[model samples]
Target: MGFGAMNLAPVYGRVEESEAADTLLAALDAGFTFVDTADIYGRGSSEDLIGRMLEKRRDEFVLATKFGGNQDSHGILIPGMGRPDYVRRALDASLSRLRADHVDLYYLHRLDPTTPIEETAGVLGELVEAGKIGGYGLSEVSPSTLRRAHAVHPVTALQTEYSPFQRAPEEELIPACAELGVTFVAYSPLGRGLLGGTVRTAADLEEGDWRRGNPRFQGGNLERNVSLADRVATLAAEQGVTTAQLVLAWVIDRGALPIPGTRKAANARANAAAGDLTLDASVFRRLEDIVPRDAAAGAQGNESYLANLDK
Candidate 1:
């Protein structure tokens, strides 16, 4: 299992510095071997926090970081990665900020719609030749784009949002990855806490929180989604596990790595424990009916967010 440190570094919450360190320590102590961070996560604070926490035992874990998104840019995100010089500079800067000589996995966070994927991937392949990154990946790309990128270089993984609610990747991306022998790293496997039954209503989120305005968390959709989540909770209770565990079990059972994020130690342990929960084919079949392809009513996010999928 991998830990996502996007919200653990106090950008959206009041997480204390010591608490962040403790969270990382708890994950490490609990046997988490992989961690996912990004240069743009918390404007670089997430990497800094993980860097400080793992300074003494850096070799004990695999570190993954992303580039391609601007740290300070607001409003709608535009596709980037135009200049080869900028890509090289970004990798060097991320290494400097991480206080490490190389990254275990380096992902281009998103494909630059304006630039050719092969060109960007070619430069990334060059970085591997230079020994700056151990493995390379792409996030949120379509099957066509992935095949094009992989043709330029051997892509190690494809990071995307894949859960019960967001199953579009299954229609094409998963099969492509299987054919190409690339790992599918599933991010947001818990549906941003919705599938875990932690969020009941839009009112529960703090002001300015991204989820508060998300379509899936608004009005009737929130109610409907919560109702669906309750069913997952019911099944989890019958299985003597938490809803989080059931969700993670389903994810890993699909043969993709589930990278769920958490700022709390208990949640980390629970998520890690999900690795041992094996769902038989019968159970998976029942779950498919329970959380069908169109189980939820609302969209995963706003139109702009989906638009960035480059479909």
Candidate 2:
């Protein structure tokens, strides 16, 4: 389990100024050693926060951040950002923003359709040799791409949407990672907070919340999804664990390191405690029956966001 720093920024909604530091400290104090962030999150604000807040406790955690994808002035994704040259610049910039000499793990935020995986992996391998990063990984990429990149350089981790809410990875991606010895990092393990039992409807999200724009949180989809999650929440109640903890525990049972982001210290502690929650095989089977891979309604990301992701 790890702390995902994306929500520390304003991406989810309006966060208090001290929220980032509070969440970071809480996560560290709660026994989370891995923290994941992205350069694109809050347009570098997340990285900046991590750098500033963790400067004193840098050795306490394994820090991971990603690059390769960027947005234009209008927040439109700029394609072809994964070129070797761009990756060099991006890593340097990320290192600067992170106030660190090297990250424990660095990942390509998304694959560059225009740039071959082998070429991008080659540069990342060189960076590892140069000590710019401890290791390199890829995000939202296909199994074949993973193999190609791994042939060039071993991928430290593969971060993607993996949860009871999103299980497309189980079909092949997760198997491929296990086969190649790549660590599978599961982001949004709580279904982006739906499995946390807070988001009941679209209106539960504040104005400007990123999930508000996600198709899964809209209209009929949100209704159906929440209905399914509520069932799991009830099972959680029976199991004497919080909904988020149950979800995280299930994710762990599936052999993933889940990194769920949060904005509150209380939520951070609750999420971290999921690591210690022991569930038996019967509980896992019951949960699986409650919410299967295709149980969640709508897409994981919006069309625009999905366009850049590996299909």
TM-score of each: 0.95, 0.97
Backbone clashes for every candidate come to 0, 0
Candidate 1 residues lying further than 4 Å off, grouped into runs, are 10-12, 71-74
Give the per-residue lDDT digits (tens) of candidate 2, residues 1-311.
89999998888889886977898899999999999999988889999988988888999999999998786655456877778889989988888998999999999988888888888999999999999899999999999899999999999999999998899999999999999999999999989888888898777899889888798999999999999998998999999999899989999999999999988999999989999988898998999999976998998878778887886
Report how far off residue 281 is in candidate 2 (Å). Answer: 0.7
Candidate 2, residue 124: Cα displacement in angstroms equals 0.2
Predicted structure with the largest TM-score when compared to the true one: 2
Off by over 4 Å in 2: 73-76
lDDT per residue for candidate 1 within 1-311, as digits (tens), equals 78877767554456777777787888888878899999887778888888777878999889999988662234355556635777888888888878899998999887776789889888889888989899899999889988998898999999999888778888899989999999999999998888977789776787656676578888998898898888888888887889988888888888789888877887888888888877677766666678889778788778766666667
Q: What's the lDDT for candidate 1?
A: 0.82
Clashes of 1: 0
